[model samples]
Target: MRAFREDESRRNAPLTAENATRVREAMRGISFAGTPPHWAELIAENNWMDRLHGVGQSSSRS
Candidate 1:
């Protein structure tokens, strides 16, 4: 998770920052076949859902 935040914050470093961006793009709108019920609550509690959807997020890139 720390690595994810690092990549998110360092968009100018293409090699490092692209990892999280690519992963997030791939995972967007994807639901695992057998996801556990508790996972939804946990993700929402941590505000991960917004990250996945890129909601209300800011980017250094214009």
Candidate 2:
């Protein structure tokens, strides 16, 4: 997760004109799945705390 955050920050950093053009070109062919189709319903039906902290009932256990 830390590595993912670092990579996201690096991707969002300001780019030089040449780099910006290259980045734009690179994104042209990209296709994003954009959150799963059932994401909202799944989230609504599930307990987030359980998902986020496993099956433990307390922070101390985590």
Candidate 3:
């Protein structure tokens, strides 16, 4: 997600419509596969369904 971390000035700036579109374009076609990096953490409680589908806990803004 380091790539998603906007520069300090940009992050502090207002999220205008144009900026939102830019973010969407930047994220397009990106996908995560294979083992997660060591810095990743599983925030959700252990569950069977997720395990069955290979889904895992994730943290995100509320």
Every model's TM-score? 0.32, 0.32, 0.38
Query: What's the CA RMSD for each of the models?
Result: 7.2, 14.6, 10.4
Instruction: Give per-residue CA lDDT, model 3, range 17-61, as digits (tens).
Output: 565557658878788999877655554435545652342122111
* Candidate 3 lDDT: 0.53
Residues 1-62 of candidate 1 have per-residue lDDT tens digits of: 99998987776443334555676688797886875687567555457756644532333232
The stretch of ten residues in a row with the least summed lDDT in candidate 2 is 53-62
Give the range where candidate 1 is weakest over 10 consecutive residues by summed lDDT.
Answer: 53-62
Comparing 1 and 2 by lDDT, which wins? 2
lDDT of candidates 1 onward, in order: 0.58, 0.60, 0.53
Clashing pairs in 3: none
Better by TM-score, candidate 3 or 1: 3
Off by over 4 Å in 1: 1-15, 32-36, 39-44, 47-62
In terms of lDDT, the best-performing candidate is 2
